[model samples]
Target: MTRLPTPAPEGDPRDGGRRLMLVEALAGRWGWSPRADGDLGKTVWAECAL
Candidate 1:
């Protein structure tokens, strides 16, 4: 599993939304699986399978 770091611009709602959109795009393009760990909202990670 590979980790893709998606750091959203702090204190910006639009950038956060864009980050979410990016995650969705990646998931659609490469079929990445997103799983939330116990710590939510602090990190966004997409697992890549080769």
Candidate 2:
């Protein structure tokens, strides 16, 4: 029988960095909604949620 490679553990700093980069790329390409008070983190989170 064939076996698949084991997946890497989650929440590693490297993984976090990769996730952040992915989020940034998505935000840049699609653009985020405007925030009521110009909160960047909130905007990023809102975009990421979508």
Candidate 3:
């Protein structure tokens, strides 16, 4: 059997606006909590409610 590796996501714009857009989309659609800024001192989390 053989498997193929996933393709990398398209590159974001150098200004990083596109990267943040992608993150927000995924978090919103998946019910995932966005990452915290280090100053928040919170644990990483993922959650969804059925």
Candidate 4:
């Protein structure tokens, strides 16, 4: 089983910044595109088969 570290408080003096950096990087990697970026609009629909 994988164990994730407990979330740190927003103002932890020692590790908060480090934790934020990790989270931000992961979010960018997996998150959806911002509405204003690229060619995507408010909705996108597609169909395909793998």
Clashes in each model (backbone N, CA, C under 3 Å)? 0, 0, 0, 0
RMSD of each: 8.9, 14.0, 14.3, 13.6
Q: What is the lDDT of residue 35 in candidate 3?
A: 38
Residue-level lDDT tens digits of model 3 in 8-45: 35683344334444444455332223336645222323
- Total backbone collisions, model 4: 0
lDDT against the true structure, per candidate, is 0.52, 0.43, 0.37, 0.41
Residue ranges of candidate 3 with Cα displaced over 4 Å: 1-14, 28-50
Residue-wise C-alpha lDDT for candidate 4, range 1-50, written one tens digit per residue:
52333446667776433454455445533222235655533222233333
Residue 18, candidate 3: alpha-carbon lDDT: 44
Error of 2 at 30 (Å): 11
User: If scored against the real structure, what TM-score would every candidate get?
Assistant: 0.32, 0.27, 0.25, 0.25
Q: How close is candidate 4 to the true structure, as a TM-score?
A: 0.25
In model 2, which regions exceed 4 Å deviation? 1-15, 28-44, 48-50
Error at 21, model 3, angstroms: 0.9
TM-score order, best first, reads 1, 2, 3, 4
- For TM-score, the strongest prediction is 1
